[model samples]
Target: MTSESSPTIGLPAGDDVFPVLPLRDIVVFPHMIVPLFVGREKSIRALEEVMRADKQILLATQQNPSEDEPTPESIFTVGTLASVLQLLKLPDGTVKVLVEGVSRAEILRYTANENYYEAHARRIADNVGDQVEVEALARSVVAEFENYVKLNKKISPEVVGAVTQLDDYSKVADTVASHLAIKIPEKQAILALPTVVERLERVLGMMESEISVLQVEKRIRSRVKRQMEKTQREYYLNEQMKAIQKELGDSEDGKDELAELEEKINKTKLSKEAREKAQNELKKLRQMSPMSAEATVVRNYLDWLLGIPWGKKSKVRNDLNYAQEVLDADHFGLEKVKDRIVEYLAVQSRASKIRGPILCLVGPPGVGKTSLGKSIAKATGREFVRMSLGGVRDEAEIRGHRRTYIGSMPGKVIQSMRKAKKSNPLFLLDEIDKLGMDFRGDPSSALLEVLDPEQNQSFNDHYLEVDYDLSSVMFVTTANTLNIPPPLMDRMEIIRIAGYTEDEKSDTSRLYLVPNILMEHALEAKEFSVDDEALKTVIRRYTREAGVRNLERELATLARKSVKELILAKKKSIKVSPKNLEDFLG
Candidate 1:
């Protein structure tokens, strides 16, 4: 591939012997002057040997730059012959040398040396191909290189100016190739080119490829810059609007609302997961527009979260005597149910913390099953909250609707807890057997979590999306029959209240029912009276029920008739005995 050759660099007459210096990560080209720091022992020794003699060294690129000690086979045979212009010894035991690449050379053989690498190489003469074509290619290369320099800021304009002054096509091609920001292999390929025209064509093609890539990069940078500017402009206008609004005395109510929520979040005693969830929701709420429906939902969620009686509980009444008195005063008989409640209170007083038992009071409707729940609350000194599970089919009714639904809220359990304003409350699930199943869901299934002592500690509500503690709540459920799901039934301790006996019903009416009826009818004890015989007659004849509910209703009728007589008939006081019980009943 050679034509008329140019005179090569002067070398030794017999053989071109030079010290070999292996380079890492760089390929030195002819007409390129570069500074190198020599740290390796062999590389430094080679530099010293070259400096001691004719100042010419064989600079070869290692096949693997990572190799600390490169062998002859590991180095490229074609390398640049560089002249050591200047050398400086640094205090760090390394030598800094200024090198100018003289000409391309190929190693003939490596000589054995103990101190450093020694090699015999021959200088490769440059070939000037077809004079006209070489000249034309050289001109085109200079123009493309100028464009490349303008596009690539790393290469200075002075480099392009210096390249334009070279008349020899080989020197022009070498100068441009030396300045290209190409890989070591690509540069070495250009350096190995024997003809000037081939080297020039390769360099020109590389420059064009680099220019196209640079143009694309420039377009991308401009587009990104414009987008950034638009975003900054919008931010600036928003800040300006806020400032104008502030000057006009228009305050940001949204900020105040968020601040209030944040304050509540900090003040409220929430579990770690619950607090993090609230903070995350607050962050989302801050990002949303105040007028949006989503913002309203988030606000409501925050309100519910803060509204819950977290870490707040009524001080349980530990006095067994007081609890027994309250239970005995509220209802007569059902001694088993009253004893169980007293036992629960007794355990609570001794234990530091106890999972309150889920007590299911199963009996007929009028047997004081629901009223027993209230008495237990009063006995234990816990707030009373009742939720009717009657006809409740939707699972959401117990566990709550997911936040994704419109106008979603926490389930009745949480709502009742909020109403009770205590973490530990006597929660009565009334008419639990009336829970129905349909397409909506089986609410009884959801009640399993609320009633289980093991799982209720971290009861999760779908709307809250966080676990709430229900372990401390005394859950009492009332059912007309034991028609509950087995899984749910398994979680609760069943307390059956067989209908009261005739003796218990009579005692209840005299002690609790009659006094309450007379007071409710606005009649003094002296003004209206029902003797024990009259009350028994009313209970056996007019209303015959196991519980005293019907007995109380009949007594209320007697009180009403007595009041009517006192108003219309002007009776001083009415005493209903077994003899006159028929008149009051009629």
Candidate 2:
């Protein structure tokens, strides 16, 4: 809605025509100078044609910007008449033109041509209103624009000066509407309005909506900034408080805990070398800041040092009769295995600082090799622990993982010692011959130091980084075969646990397996019982193993089936017989 009084230079008079260029998603209002890159063949040709004659062209915007080739129907008929201010030829066959919109135009008819698009356009002039009314409206529009500029800090303050300098009310309205933030179609609507008052009114409504959105965004940004400042202040205050507390010596900060650990370590009777190492580690811990990562490492090492039973040993039973009685009561058959353990206990009770042999019980599975270890524990009054060496390829598992590695821990020997809370315990290394080797390292080689009494008096682990006394630890290793590493076999006194005879299976089943089966099924011995004949049938027909493990399983199966029959048939009692054994088993 620009004034007709202003000169429209380069614009054709009346219905005179000029070349046309299609714009996408952009509305060019009168008095707006914009630079455009002309890439389309028709648009580029139109720019060249306009540059040749009067430097004028009609600029129309398309309805859908996504359309590659827009028909006349897709473009709005009401457009702007623009004059080319400057022209530059780009290297990529595209021409860049600086154009200023001269006035609004209406397309009456289009001229068909091959080189460029031509249209017959009529220049539109603003419908002037009363002079007094126009002046009052201009004042109102300028004030509202000031408020809009305050909301959007991005809008230049020079726009207020430009609006004030323009004397014509129509030109002021058109200039302000052009700079306002709004949708392209809304701006196009204002451009097409014939009267200045209509354009100003539409612009005012849109300006109010834009101010509301900007106000919300500004409030959110201000709140976030305040919250961030508050968090930073709180963090600064907390750090100052920590500094004050540390200066006053009121903070625990691990110092008190470290002192208590040091006192405990000094009071305990440790070897001269171990005590010196512990004291040296404590000195380093005192020098480190409590919050640092290295301090935590020192603290963990001190905890391991304090946890070991430095001088305490388990009380050994010197009476050989009590040891033999315990062995006979716990396990049946394998008198040879039981006799060997009793002899070791008798020798251990008599000698001081004696290097006893590491007893290796080689046999098939479930033949009382592991049970013999437990019986040894009961006989000597020592705690028992079993470490399975099967499928162990890492030497770190036999020795310890180095402290540099994550989740590093002591080996099975040191861990068992810590758990037993004594210097001596019966450690059963189960399935020793089954140890494996791979790229990690061989576990069997690491076990050599652990089993040898000469090397084991001061066994050093990679993680402990100190010598641990394993001379008092009674080691009993069990294996299913005699095929073990030569070095490991040399340290141990190998005892054989051969497969049981049919008579041995029958006796073990009746004494140990039968009572355990009844207890497992939660049945009373008077309500259900297994006879010697039925036990023999299970040993001969159902099971064929080197140990009593299969015989135990068969008895458990028979007990479960017989218990179910008693519950269903409402019988008071049931006897397991050889002939009726299949009825319960099936």
Candidate 3:
């Protein structure tokens, strides 16, 4: 097919095949050329497979597997089928290949034996016969691309023109569309369009949108730069004033300042990590002769570190009776679960008690799963930190993104501790069962360390890449169901918070619900309060849930509506009865 009259010969044309190339942001069409740099282990293996195969490899978009596995998907049903024109291995362990798109194809199942993801492809219809205004579309698209090129930062107009005059309109659109800075999903949409006119129109719309976004981004960057410049100048002025004042100091004045600082430093107890950071800052002050406001900024940070509550542990009264009292103060039922929490606190009374027993509350929504964790924290006089695991599919989020990635952060465990402003506090991991599996990574596997007490004491997040002490921290987890991983599930003590029985609901409402509802609905002391019969009527007639929570809401509703009427009608208050339930509700 090389150095021939036509890209594909009509004489005894070989059986048509499509190689499902899975490259992103770059689409190659027949008579359209694109270059790819392959270096990853997957890419290298893919190259090797293609070099060895008798027929060309079909490039395809990856498909996800039904089961949880590391494999990617097959190519999109509509993709450019291409042949590798040339292949050369670079010194940097990358394969340099020139590939030209050939025809449209549908991807079959993944091929075996590949370093890169490859799919078996069968050709779709050749060049469409019913094209009407495709050639005019190509010219108009070319002009649009030329304008797009001039608009792109630093892109050469000559390069754009060369791409435009190429033989295939489909290839031109694909090549230009690939580099348009459109979102991946939008690019996939363009790839999926079946016809030349459709593909061209989609690409044009996407390109225009990309240009608009670029314009907005340029304005945003300029505005930010101006703001930063103003801030830096202000900082420079403040530090210059401080330095000038210090320069006018006497020997004894310096001594006095040093003495005050030394006294504070002596009083300051520091963590090993924070102390080391402060010491480094002091050394920086000793060094770096061409100092600026940034240097002064570092010195200020040192001062803050000296003043911070490092090596400070909050006072926690570890009495089981006290914890029980706190729990009873707010919640009415869940007697069994509350008792277990008290037992946990009793065990904490041991001098050498192992970190806390990881307690997971399994129950339905509004069963006070989150509120209960807060109550436990209040009972122990410790701070509570919550990490919601719902919709957390990225492994980076659960385990922290790798620090090498831009804006990487510590996993939820490390982040929660930092947020609580304490190394040891009560951590509530919510919705542990709702983690999703995706190409980014499985969040469940990422939770392996944070939930495991043995491993969690030295939990390492990918972003922080530092092992944090989670041993002394008490961890609580909540889920609607016990659908958590077996290994993770085994590590925690499961406390079942059953739906309240009808009798329990009625009793709990009488004590906790009535009073709380009165306070929340702003009802006066003399307001017609919710009586036993009225509350019972409302609960039986209005709603039915396992938890008294909904019943409590209904009670609150009665108070709110009646309170409004009490203020409006001067008939101070009406006694709530089964017959008068409609007055409050309606």
Which 10 consecutive positions of candidate 1 have the poorest summed lDDT? 1-10
Cα RMSD (Å) between model 1 and the true structure? 10.4
Off by over 4 Å in 3: 1-310, 351-357, 399-409
Residue 435: error of model 2 in Å? Answer: 1.2
User: How close is every model to the real structure, measured as TM-score?
Assistant: 0.59, 0.56, 0.49
Candidates 2 and 3, the one with greater lDDT: 2
Best by TM-score: 1
Native-referenced Cα lDDT, model 1: 0.86
Cα lDDT, model 2, residue 65: 82
Q: Compute the lDDT of residue 332 as modeled in candidate 2.
A: 77
Estimate, for each residue in 1-586, the C-alpha lDDT of model 2 and write its tens digit: 2334433333354888888898987888888899988789988888877877765799999888887788878888889988899999999998888999888899888888867778888998766555556566777888888888988887899988888788667677788888888887888888888777777777777877888898898999999999999989977875775576588664684657877978888798877877888899887776566767887877887787678778789886678898899888877778877787777777878888658778899999878888888888888888888899888888988788788976777877777788888888888999989889999988888888888888888899887788888888888999999879988888888889887889988888778888888898999988888788887888888888899898888888888877887899898888988878878665
Better of 1 and 3 by lDDT: 1
Return the lDDT, model 3, position 426: 79
lDDT of 3 by residue, 1-586 (tens): 0112232321232344323346654444444567887656676676676678845656554343222223544335556666778999988878888877666566655656444566555565433223445666666777778777766876767768677667666666677776676665566677667666777777877777767877787899899999999989978975675576567652344335445655565566655665565566655544333245555555454554453334455567787778888898878778888988888778876745355557899998767889899999999888889999998888888776663554444566666666777656778999988878789987887677776767876666665443555666778999989998887887888998877766777778777777777787777657756667777777677867766667767777777778777788877776788778887775
Candidate 2: stretches off by over 4 Å: 1-253
Clashes per model (N, Cα, C within 3 A): 0, 0, 15
